[model samples]
Target: MTAHGLVIGKFYPLHAGHLGLVRFAASESAALTVIVLGTVFESGSHERRADWLRAELAAAGAELGHVEVLAVRCDAPEEYGTEIAWVANVAIMRAALAAAGRPAPTAVFSSEPYGVELAARFGAEHRAYDVAREGHPISGTAIRADLAGRWSEVAPAARLDLATRVIVTGAESTGTTTLTTALVDHYRANGFAAMPVVPEYGRDFTYELHAETEERLGREVAMDDLVWLPEHFARIAERQNELEDAAAMACPLVIADTDAFATELWERRYLGATSDETHRFGTDRLPPRDVYLVTDHVGVPFFQDGWRDGEHIRADMNGWFVDELTRRDASWVLLRGAPEERLRYAVRLIDALWARNATFASPPWRSSPPSVE
Candidate 1:
């Protein structure tokens, strides 16, 4: 069937405001041409915006079969006047429709002032839908602002799937705990599920091996150098295995405070010079992490107690940990800057990765099980 009307806009996210226009056009026309204009611009990628718009329309109960979402590229001169720019856009839209073997639309739908003029140029019926009155209008400006923490609002149908697991690593007194807590808060506040690593080894082994030490050796010795010894490495490894197994069984998205690889770094640093056995035990142990995040030494002045090491060693150890993780062929993201700013950057990176993963609909082989002859 031929398209009865055409709708044009960037539709960066196709939120509730855009839904009103689509519903209005659907009532007047048998089929609507949802032309996604200026798709080739660098501001917002066409494929990214198109996918979001498609999902939004589908959720709004619009018929995918009758709704045509077209991505048209326009390259008009920068010095051109508004009238000339409109003419250029019209030419591009007409060509796009002709290439798709569809007739020109009878009416045009838009909420912008330019919509009326574009409709007149195409000799099509003009209809304006009020975006501000309808509800939340999803624009790039508003989305970016929300991300920057100016507002606590997000799109109702916003995709909150963070596919990658974030693993934070550092020795004690390096602000690892602070960073993990901050990340969890940031993600959870933004409507994503983030699980924190509880370090079962410290509690489990403490009760088993160090339980008696706490009574005999006292709190200072038990909490200090003894916990960093080679004998305790086995319990640490076991705890790490438990966490990894649980994460693998649970969800693909997780945030771990410290992984087994980081534990290995501690073993090498604390163990004596001739402790080859301890090094071998740590090397053979530990599971692979998807992405390892290392924090920089910006002199943030972290608190240190009797059990904690100096900032110099902590900073040096962080560098060695990153190098070792890299040598093991594990992907890593180095987080720098202030605590909140770093958290924001990490969240944005995770969001972008998740969005990319979502873009891949499905593979051909996965569509159906192996066909029998």
Candidate 2:
């Protein structure tokens, strides 16, 4: 007879400690049934936690049949501690497992003393590990207290909220791309293996559209040509943020080339107007990043990239970027001076941020949107 193992929790923002329990269960049992019981009070989404578990378990060294993640929603686990309430909780877990074709677990694995009682409910053996938490030395409660301070404690698949995004924004001819690449290389070389470069979607989309026009009509199109259209901008801005969000989920530290806010400034340059639809789509529709480093067009060589509108447009756009960022009271750092100097400054800023976060004990995440500054 095989010991079918079971582990249950919110895995609420599953941390390293939870991983330890999962690893232990997988090793001891023939099959490990992970039941993620989520209430309305959990920090992360139930779906996200479930998805994170699936990704992790699939990657973990376990037989295909030995590990499984199941999401089962129930009453708030904290709302009651009565004996009957636990009986009810056990009933819900048992029903869901049975419905999914899992045998009542032969062993219940947990770090809490309640495991003894929980196992008794099913007449299963109580197997507890790390009840003292001496190895991992961290808890989900500690994570809730300081998400930034404990970012690495967050599991890989559930790490989007902990992501630190550094956006490089500037007008044409500026060193945005160069600085973005440098920063990405720096972050990756040190650690942060999943660092991503979210390139400007507007440019890519417009470039493709421009190319198609030239091929079809035999007349070349440019960036300014499409700026007057609100629909094009709105589409670009919305998708731009989506790309950032997706990248952040993987990296936990993203280096963006440009963002939707830059798209708005670009639109203002060519259309001689701003799009209300674009503004909201950029600001309201997406998760905001923590830092925006604006590169200066001056002290850098200017060259037309087949799509650029030259020095005059570049100058005007630079002013617009600064003016708008100020008017909106958005957080941003202006990078000037030599290329090497600029890169060093950016590196120092991020380096210092992480250094501070290393000791930071306050929570970085909240129920609402977080700011850059």
Candidate 3:
């Protein structure tokens, strides 16, 4: 008979220790189920945590085969060591398992003392691993208390979602790419090993479209020759968001030359109004952004890199960005002056953004007020 193993936790933010526990359980069972229990108070939703769990398991490259992830939401008061709370939690877990079509687990694995009773309630044997902090020496609480300091302890899958996303947007030849590269370099030099910059996907899309049009016409296609479509802008916006998300997974600091949100502005600039399809694929799908850096067109000569419009419309383009960003009440900084000067101010703004991201909101379970130093 095959033994089905179960591991459950809040995974407040999945960390290395949680991975270790799940890994150990997977090794011992024919099939394993990881339950990501969530609460209304948690910042990460149950589905999001499950995504993180799936990503980490998938990264193990078959070492964690036959493992499934599910989620259970429980908002009952977390009164530790109380019979009422334990019973309530257990009922929620059983209901979730049944709803998910999972069988009764033969073994329940956990690092908490509650594992004993949790297993008993399900008629499963309790298998405790690393009851002490010897193996990973980290907890969700500790990780939450100092998220940035313990960033390495966080599971690789969760890091991407938690990363600070900085997006740079501007009119043609306004140094958006220049500032993006500079900020990425600055972070890498400042010890951010995995700082990655997502290049503008719109340009890539435009190039492909231009090439395709030229091939069809059997002639060199001018920038105007490329016909823009609402669906085309939607694709660009969606891809831009995808690229940013993928780059964010590599490290905590992710810089994007442009993002899905920027795609909407580009759509309006070309089409006279933002299409429903573009808007749907743009800001609606954008990941939470820390700040938007708008590069100023002043003093920057347009290079007209063959794909770009002329300098005459550069101010108009910049104005669109400023107006839209202001209307949305989004956090943004206008970068101006020479490259070096622009970089200096950009660094200060990003430093503040990084500091703010590093500060984790206190979990709702903590009843006492935080001590002020």
lDDT of each: 0.59, 0.75, 0.82
Task: For model 2, name the residue pairs that clash.
Answer: none
lDDT score at residue 268, model 3, on the 0-100 scale = 86
- Using TM-score, give the best candidate's number: 3
Q: Model 1, which residues run further than 4 Å from truth?
A: 1-3, 39-41, 60-65, 77-82, 131-140, 144-146, 149-178, 182-331, 334-373
lDDT of model 2 at position 26? 81
- Taking all chains together, each candidate's TM-score versus the true structure is 0.48, 0.60, 0.71
lDDT of 1 by residue, 16-73 (tens): 5566677677777788877765433334455555566676677667354477777766
Best by lDDT: 3
| By lDDT: ranked, best first | 3, 2, 1
Residue range 1-373, candidate 3, lDDT tens digits: 2399999887768888898998899999999988887767666587888898898888897899789899778776665568887788778878888998989899999888768877898899999888886998988878777675677788877887788888899999999999999899998888686666699988888889988999999998788888999999999888887788777766677888988877898888888888887898766667878889999999997897777878998899899889888898889899889999999998898888777766655446655311100
Between prediction 1 and prediction 3, the one with superior TM-score is 3
Ranking by TM-score: 3, 2, 1
**Residue 158 shift from truth in candidate 1, angstroms:** 5.5
**What lDDT, from 0 to 1, does candidate 3 have?**
0.82
Give per-residue CA lDDT, model 2, range 299-339, as digits (tens).
Answer: 88898877777877777777878887888787789898888
Q: Candidate 1 at residue 359, lDDT?
A: 40
The Cα error of candidate 2 at residue 41, in Å, is 20
